[model samples]
Target: MRYKRSTQERSLTSPARTTAPHVKKNVDRYGTTKLGKAAEKGDLEAVKQAYEQSPDELNQPDYAGIAPLQKASLKGHAGVVAYLIKQGCRPDVQDDQGDTPLIDAVTNGELDVVRILLKHGVNPHHSNSNGQRAMDFLE
Candidate 1:
């Protein structure tokens, strides 16, 4: 005999359950730069040190075409995102998939990071290679 599942269990196994595509796309790529790694980990201090050691690398993308800002936004690292923007990292920089930090933050449900990007004047209407706008990811 089959037993009825609780609401929480049903939710966990529901067809509505979904993972952000960008999270899967970027997480498996271990070839990120030092800044990208620190940003992904949300280590603001380490990000600062990494930037100090190589300021020019701040806007550089890793082998996966993901930059530090994108990683920070992906992981909802609001402070790191703020710091990167303050230090002149382009808020609209797109990865190989044409996703900006704004797109990354929105897709990952990082509201704070999304707010930070918007407050800093990121282009919300920018579309990724898939032709989806950042606002399209809002739940």
Candidate 2:
């Protein structure tokens, strides 16, 4: 399902000069913010920079409700996942499909990311919208 941002919704890619603060912004048309892109690429430094610019963006979801943490988890970026968790990103946050970071990591066979998420206390038994739990994906 594609989500269309309303006119009032800001884009994270918007120029930094914009004065509006506190308004949650959507990612670009691709459903990824600078932070999300950085996380997806396993660029920890870029993630840090993007996060520092907008702390709130840490938990902000893309059009599909996928947060940067989930993106990192999907790509098996253990360092990025750890850093995001340290930055207060919710480990159990669900995407539009109700898949959490733990689920993403497990589904993608990202064992290291899975370990980090488990160590952080994410719920392994948590189920997605389809009733599939993280443990269900375990080998």
Candidate 3:
């Protein structure tokens, strides 16, 4: 036999028992369009200002799926790249497709950029889902 009616089903209906859906912080939406584009244009001051104004600048990505560091490296902007590194932007942070800044440097045949990325802790062995690593992207 069942345990009979205990405290009734009302306990399960308590208003406080309801759960709310999780919502991400709105800050995540703020990508450094200014900073990333500045990196592309080799605008060091703009890149610096963008980073200073938005600490989350590291998370910003361009339309090409390139993060700030990736954009800087792609443009071969050593100054902007160095400044981003100082602000804690990682070179190996892959985009949606897992294309890291190192991959961009390698593919572009930017030797200095690749060396800088490697020095900043980008793993050369890391691969995307397509099985392409920074090494694969190398010229």
Candidate 4:
């Protein structure tokens, strides 16, 4: 369901880098440009480089509103997951479908990922599109 925008779309939506004197409003200055996929695949080096170039990329939501940290959790990428949390990514960020990282981790039976996210205070009670909580997925 993740679609890569065409060059024309990227150009059209790319925000103008404004100075302090001319702040733009209601624009996602930081765009999701394959970093979320890299994070989900647990490529720490790619994640590192992406963050180095645009640390704000960590906060950028995909069209589905899924954050990179959430993808990392769903894929059970522990190293990237840890690094993302240390970098201040919220473990409880919900996607447009209301699915948090904890929800994915639990449903995938990834106990370690669930533990790490819980340590970061991700709500186990957070429901997803199906109205199911993380605890509901626990065995």
| Top of the candidates by TM-score | 2
RMSD of each: 13.5, 7.0, 10.7, 8.9
Q: Return the TM-score for each candidate structure.
A: 0.77, 0.82, 0.71, 0.75
Model 3 stretches astray by more than 4 angstroms: 1-32
Instruction: Quote the positional error of residue 25 for candidate 4 in Å.
Output: 17
List the pairs of residues colliding in candidate 4: none
* Better by lDDT, candidate 4 or 1: 1
Candidate 3 lDDT tens digits, 35-116 = 6767778898887786676566565553335677887787788777888887888767777688787877888887888878
Q: The CA-based lDDT of model 4 is what?
A: 0.74
Ranking 2 against 4 by TM-score, winner: 2
The pairs that clash in candidate 2 are none
Estimate, for each residue in 1-139, the C-alpha lDDT of model 2 and write its tens digit. Answer: 9998554534454433232335344456655678988999999999999999878788877766788999999999999999999999998899878999999999999999989999999988888889999889877
How many residue pairs collide in each prediction?
0, 0, 0, 0
| Residue range 1-139, candidate 4, lDDT tens digits | 8998543333234343222211112224443445676797899999888888667667666555678988888888988988999998877788878989888888898888888988888778777888889888878
Q: Tell me the deviation in Å of residue 47 in model 2.
A: 0.5
